[model samples]
Target: MQLTHFNASAKAGVSRASSRRTTVRVQAAAARPSWFPGNKLPEHLDGTLVGDFGFDPLGLGVDKDKLRWYQQAELVHARFAMLGAAGILVPDLFHQIGAGGPAAQIPWYDHAKFEYYAPINALFGVQVLLFAWAELRRLQDIRNPGSVNQDPIFSQYRCVCACV
Candidate 1:
């Protein structure tokens, strides 16, 4: 004797209850992770990013565009910091090894006291201006990607000056 819901009311009631339970389970499974029961992880961070561990306590990086911008900014800052470290270390290392001449004798801190000739000063000014222009162009590129045709080989006049 098999017990079946032959009655229309009984079948409808059972189906509704099961469907409701399944819906709730699906929502719970999709939203919250097992480790963090309190906070529901955002749907966007699906553990695919470089360092994504799904640990967004502050709820930052919710916007995809802002997140990408932040990532790029971090990379740029990190690269600059590495360059600064190298800049400090290389001169000091050369000084310690007794390789460099008069310039190396001056410690990194006291290098500001060293006087430069007019030509050198002019060159430094030109370098600063060129760096500023490049930085502005890079900033524009970041703000509007593909806006600056940064093709080093095939840029304006095809001279490859930008690559240098």
Candidate 2:
């Protein structure tokens, strides 16, 4: 089961439910269970749809509340890490690399490149996710969790101070 980021020309027929997290939501279209919030993104292996993973046997089963927090943090942390790494790769976010790309994928050049930052990015990304999950759990512990009781994305992207 290879994980891909995009769908293929054949499976492009899948529609976005504006709710799913990966492309596997297509398999459940016939049932449309209430637990799954259809995701628009498609999961493919090198642009080919082998099949939907629905709930893969990789032991990904987790508490939705906990997952929501982790996913949000993961998204933000990825953005920041990409920004930081891209800063190392191409300081200018808008800059492009001269190679095969849709132009949008091109990257400028990074001036102060770090040899160890690659590993650092991976470590930091995981740390950010764990921290966000802990924060959410902490908030849930409060007698009155307050306004932070918003959507997962909100809790994840909200300013750290805003967590109050």
Candidate 3:
């Protein structure tokens, strides 16, 4: 008896290797920062993205260029960590999706748990974005299925990716 896995490059059903490494390579190539994980979107609902916003946090309405390093680093660091966290959770998350439950079933919003859903949704949305992207790519792996696709808000990461 044999268990075979496909080489990521060419086709799904291909050759067999004793120990093939796919996830690590993808993760390494992604090179996501420990501080900011790729899965979490750095942007907020206000459309203000990570680090320094183009506008002002002080209500001075200044540009990101005007901000200091520590301030910017703080946000940068948080965003990076969330992004990485999302990616790390991908494997098992997808497995659960495939089994029988969809993402919506998860405790995304425990109405009983929160007096408000806005901020919670926002933070969770970032996490969801990461899960969403993974489930989209690996629907088969998801324990329960959810219609996975790009969350337009989180797509801002595309720009961040280019800048980095």
Best of the candidates, TM-score: 1
The per-model lDDT (C-alpha) reads 0.69, 0.49, 0.46
Q: State in Å the error of residue 92, model 2.
A: 6.5
Cα RMSD for candidate 3?
25.7
Q: lDDT tens string, model 3, 24-120?
A: 3223254333333344433322333453323333443333443333454466578879977774466347646664234333343343463554677
lDDT per residue for candidate 2 within 1-164, as digits (tens), equals 33336534445566653332343333434542222357333222122212333433343424546545555556777887987876555433343444433333433343224344467779789999998887666556443554554555655665455445
- Model 3 TM-score, all chains together: 0.20
Q: Could you estimate the TM-score for every candidate?
A: 0.52, 0.27, 0.20
Stretches > 4 Å off in candidate 3: 1-67, 99-164
Ordered from best to worst TM-score, the candidate numbers read 1, 2, 3
Candidate 1 local lDDT, 1-164, one digit each (tens): 23333223456446543321112222334543434666566777886677665676666788888887777778888998999988778888888999777777788888777775656679789999988887887778778866666555566643334333
Query: Cα lDDT of model 1 overall?
Result: 0.69
Q: Distance from true position, residue 155, model 1, in Å?
A: 6.4
Q: How many backbone collisions does model 1 have?
A: 0
- Off-target runs (Cα >4 Å) in candidate 1 are 1-42, 55-58, 116-132, 150-155, 158-164
